[model samples]
Target: MQTGGHIAGWRHARAADNALCDAEYFQALGRTAEKGLFDGVFLADYVGYHPVKGAAVFAGLETPKLDPLVVLATIAAATRNIGLIGTASTTYSHPYDVARRFASLDHVSGGRAGWNIVTSTMENEAHNYGFEAHLAHADRYARADEFVAVARKLWDSWQAGAVVADKVSGAYTDPARISAVDHQGEHFRVAGPLTVPRTPQGHPVLVQAGASATGQQFAAANAEVIFTSHPTIFTAQAFRADMHTQLAQFSRSPESLKIMPAVTPVIGRTRSEAEDLKRELDDLIPARIAISKLEGLLGNVDLSGADPDGPLPALPAEALAGENSTRDRVLELSEREMLPIAELARRVAAGRTGHTIVGTAEDIAETLIEWENCGAADGFVISAPFLPGGLEDFVDMVVPILQERGHFRREYEGTTLRENLGLAVPPNGFDADPTSRRRPEIW
Candidate 1:
C-alpha cells in the first residue's frame, strides 16, 4: 500500500486566495513524494462548484475550481517518476476528448498519468452546466458505464507501431495498422481513429472513486485502481469484501483492483503533539461555518445554536438522502461510537469521515499494515490535515516504516504507472480488417 496526496487546502486557508498553491508548490510536493519512494500523487478534482445548500459544505472558498488534469500536466514537466492522477467527470465530458488528453499526458510523462472517473454528484454543478436538475444517480451511472466503454475503445484505437512516420514514400502511418471504431452506445456515438497514437501504457490507468452500489459494479468492471471512502476499519473491510463479490459477478479477478480508502494524517514527533495539532486544525472550523455546512448536507435542517451535547434533532425520513457519502459515513460512525454531538462534529470536520490516523511513524505504519492484512484495504489515499508540510512529514516518517516491514516496494517495477503498480497492460485496437472479420458459428 503506497501513499498519495490530494492538492486541497481551499477550505481552511487563512489567506484570501488559497485556491491551490502555485505551480512551484505542486512541483515541490511531487519531488518530495518521489524522494520518499512512494508510488505516486493522486489529485482529487471536481467539476463545477459544490452545492451550497443541498449536499456540499463549500463555505469561504471559491467554487468551480481549477482543472485537475491541466494542473497535473504542468506538474508532469517538472517531475520525473511520480504518478499524476486527475479527476475528470464522465457526465459532462466526451469520451474521445478524455481519451486523447490522458494518452497525451502518458506520453509526456513517460507513462505516469492516471484518470479518476467521477459522475458529478452535485445538483449545483448540473445547473451550472445547463441542466435544470441533476440526473438521477442510477442514470448517471448508466451513462458512465457506456462512457467508460467508449473511452476504452478510443484509447485502443491505435495500436503500437501504427505510426510508421516513414519518409521515403511519404507514408506517415501504416494504414493497415489503424482503423475506425464503430461504437453506437446508449450514451455515446463515436466513430474513431483516435487523434493521438498509443500511449506508453497502452492507456493511462483507469481509476474509479465510487462507493454507491451502482458505482461499485462499474468499478469492478472498469477500474484497475479503486479510490474509496471509509470511516472505520469495519466499514473498510465490508467494502473490500463487497467489491470482491462484485468482481466475481463481473468474471474478473478481484485481486487485480487495488482498493485505497482515504486516510488523513496529522502527524507530529509525539502522539500528544499530534493530538494537539489535530485539535488546532479542528478548532479552526468556525461554529457558524460548521453549522452552515451541516445544514446544507442535512437538507436545510438547521442545527445552528443547538446544544452540541444534546441529541441530534430528529431528521425527516428523507433527510439523509442525497447527502455526501463521507459525511453520512461519519454520522454513522459517531452514532456507533455514541459520541457527543460536539466532538462528533469536530472529528467529522477534520477529515470528512475518512480514517484519521494521527500518531508517531510506528503507530501509523502498524495501523496501515493491520488494515491491509485484515481486509480493511489494499492501501490508502493519504491526505494531510495541513498543506505541503503535512505531506512532507508522512513521506519522511511513515513511508520508511512501511518499507522496512517489507510491505512496500523500495523501487518501481516498470515504466508506466500501471506497470509500476503491477496492473495489466490494456489490449490493442482493432487488429483484423472489418471486411475480413467473421463471427464464429454458434454452438
Candidate 2:
C-alpha cells in the first residue's frame, strides 16, 4: 500500500491566512510525511492563474509560487526517506530538458525522485508558453506520447556498467558501453545520450494524472503511479478495471501500476468534531468563490448565468468532450442526486463531491482499507484540506491507526521510490532484447 502527501491543501479557506510561500512549511510537511513512512510527497504545479476568479483566488493559493522541482529539491535535502514527485508539463517543456532535470533530481535524491507527467490543459498556460490557445486534447496527448518515448530512450542511452572511473589507467568511462539515442520522433528529436548516467533506480518512476480514456491508456502503457480523483467507489472501480484491461493489451502486468485516488480526510478525535471542522471550512468559503472554483473544475464553464437555486443548465456537447474528468464526475453526481446548482457547488466546496471523508482517525482508516481491499484503489494521495495543521493531524492521528491496523508500513521499506512502490527498474535499452520491450501504443 502506497500513500502520498499533497501540499496544495493550503489553498483552502481554513488555511487562507497561512504563509504558503514559506520554505520551512513545506520542509516540515515533507518530514511529517517521512515520519509517517509515506511513499512520497507530491507537489502539484500550474503555470497559469485563474483570472476569472479574480485576485481573491490568488490571495490564498500557491499558484504563482515557487517551481515544483525547486521546492522538491529543497524538500529532498530536508528529508531522507520520502519520495519527491514533482509535476511537469510535456505540453510546455522540451523532452531533453525534462529528462535531464528529472535524471539529475534522481541522482541528487539517491533515486527518490518521480516525474508526474502532465499535458497542461489551462489556456492561460498556453498564453504563457507563447501560444494563442491550448492544444487540442488529442494533439496534446500525441505530443506527450512522443515526448515520453524520447525521454525513455535518452534515459536508456547509457549502459549500467558504462561508468568505470579508474585512477591507475586514467579511464573515467568506458566509451564502448554508451551510445547515442539518435531518436527522431514527431514531437521531439534527440541526438545523443543524456549528460548524466543511469540513475540509482535506472529511471525515475513515471507518475501520471489523467483520467480520460486517452489518459488512462497512456498511463497503462508507461506510468507506474497514477493519481486521479473519483467521487464514488463505483467510478474508481470502473477506472481500475479499464486500466487493467489496457495493461493486458500491452502485455504488462496489472501489478506494474498503482492507482491512487485523491482523498481529503477531515479528521478529529470524534466524528462530531470532524464534522464541525468540515463545516467551519465550508462556511469560510464565499459563495462566489465556491462557484468560481466549481466553474474552473468544470473546464471553466460559465456558471454566472446559472441560477444559483436551480438545477445546472444544459451543458454543451463540446464541453462534455473536453479533457477535464472532474467535470464529467461532477455532472454525473449532479444528475444522480438531482442537485441544485448552488447545492452542487457547496458539495464540491466541502470536498464532498471529490471523495472527501469527514470522520475520526479510525473512520478514515476503515474507509481507506475498504477502498484498497475492494480494488477501488491501490492506495490514496492524501489531499489535506489545510497545510501543517491538516497534515499534522493525519500524520499524528490517522497514520498511527493505519499502522496499528497493519494496513500501512511502520518504517521506510526501501531507499528508492521504485523500491518502496514495488516497481521494477526499467531495463537499459542496450541490454534488453528488442522483443521484450513494451512499446507504448500511440492513439
Candidate 3:
C-alpha cells in the first residue's frame, strides 16, 4: 500500500513519557523516512490524555504528547521530500492562528505543510482548556466545519508574485496584492488579509481523522488525505464505500480524498519470528495496566477474572458513548471473528483498531497490495508501539520489499509535499482581482 509514517509513539525515547518530544529527534525521523522512500510523516496530537476512573489517563504504555506544529517545523528543516503533517484541533483553536501557523510552516519548509484537522474529544482536555465538559460529537463537528471554512478563507488571502521586492522603488511588497475575507461564521469571526503572504502551495493540504457521520461529511467536502482507523478489512471497505457516497453527495469524487487507515507492522524474517515478536510486545504490557486500559476503553467491566478463552463480558448501555466508536467498532469485529476475550483485548492493545500485519517483508507487501487493490483503503498511516526499533524494522525490511514490487515510490518526484503527492497547487484569494482586493482600507 502507499506508505506514510506517523509520529505518535516515536516521541517517548528520551523525554518523560508524558512530556513533549524534542525537535532534533523528529528531524532525525524525517531524514530516516525520506531515506526509506516514504511519502510523508504525519504527527498525531491529542489535546488531553484519555481519562481512567476520573483522572487524566497515564499508565503503562501512555505518555509524551507533543505539539505537532512545532514538531513538524523541526522535521521540515531536516528533510525536503517527505510531507510534514501536524494535527490542529478545530474545537480548541481559532482559524486565524491556525492559518498563520501552517502558512509559516509551509514557507519555512518550502511548501510541505499538511494539517490534520480534529474535533477534540477528551473531557479532561476540555477542562484544561477552560471548559467543564466535552462538546457533543455532532456539535464539535459542526463548529469544526465552520472553523475550516474560515481558515481556508484566511489562507486564500495573498497571491504569488504579490510581493515585488523592487529595491529600486523601495517597495518591499506590492500594495495591490492581498484581499480580505470578512468571514463571520458560527464558530469563528476571522477578518482576514492574513499578515503572512501565501506559501508555495497557496494553502496547506487539509487532512481529517474523524469517522462519525458529521465528520465524514466534513472530510468529503474538505480533506485531501483522511487518516482513519478500522480493525478489519470488512469495516475498512465499508468505510471506504461510505466516504465515496459522501463525496458523491458533495458532487465531489473519491479521487479528491485519499483514505488511509492506521496500520502497525510486527515484522520479522520468518513467520515464527513474527509471532514471537508480537508475543514479546504484549508480555511487556503488565496485567494491571492492560485491565485499566481495557476498562478505560470497554467501560469499567472487570475483565480481571475473566478467562482468556471465555466469551466477552456483556456491554452496558452506559458504555455506548459516541466518542468510543473506534473501540466499539473493534468489539464488533472481534465478535464477528469469534475471537476469545483475551485475544480480542490483545489485538486492540496492539494497534488500537489499526490493522496489524505480521510476517516476512514479502508477506506484508502482498497483504498491503491486496488491501490497496481491493477497495479496503487507499493507503496506510503506519504506526508503531515503541521507539526506533518499531520504525527501523519497517524501514529496513518492509519498505524495500514494497519498493521492489511496483506499488511504492522508489524516489520522491517533487521537492514540495503537495507536488510529491500529486496534488495541484492552489491559487491565492486575489490573483483574479488586482485592484479591488488590494485596497489598504479592506484590511
Kindly give the number of clashing pairs for every candidate: 0, 0, 3
- Superposition error at 339 for model 1 (Å): 3.9
Best candidate according to lDDT: 2
For TM-score, candidate 2 versus 3, the one ahead is 2
Better of 1 and 2 by lDDT: 2
Candidate 2: pairs in clash: none
Q: Residues 248-303, candidate 3, lDDT per residue (tens digit)?
A: 98887687788998888777799999888777776755545555566656745566
**lDDT comparison, 1 vs 3, better candidate:** 3
Q: Could you tell me which 10 consecutive residues in candidate 1 have the lowest summed lDDT?
A: 1-10
Off by over 4 Å in 2: 1-17, 56-63, 433-443
C-alpha lDDT score of every prediction, in listed order: 0.73, 0.81, 0.74
Residues 123-157 of candidate 1: C-alpha lDDT, one tens digit per residue: 66788789898787788888998888888777777
How does model 1 fare in lDDT? 0.73
Q: Which pairs clash in model 3?
A: 17-63, 17-64, 18-64
TM-score of 3: 0.89
Ranking by lDDT: 2, 3, 1
The C-alpha RMSD of each candidate to the native structure, in angstroms, is: 4.7, 4.4, 3.7
Q: Tell me the lDDT of candidate 2.
A: 0.81
lDDT, model 3: 0.74
Which lDDT tens digits does candidate 2 get at residues 1-443? 01112223444544534555667767887998898888999977778855566676555322345688888888899988799999999999999999999999998999999999999768889999899988998899999999999888878877787799999999987766676777777877778678888889888889999878888888988899999888888888988988999999989998999999989889878999999877777666667766776777677788888789999998877678766666777888899989898878877766635588999999999999999888999989888877767877889899988888889987777999998999999988777754333322220
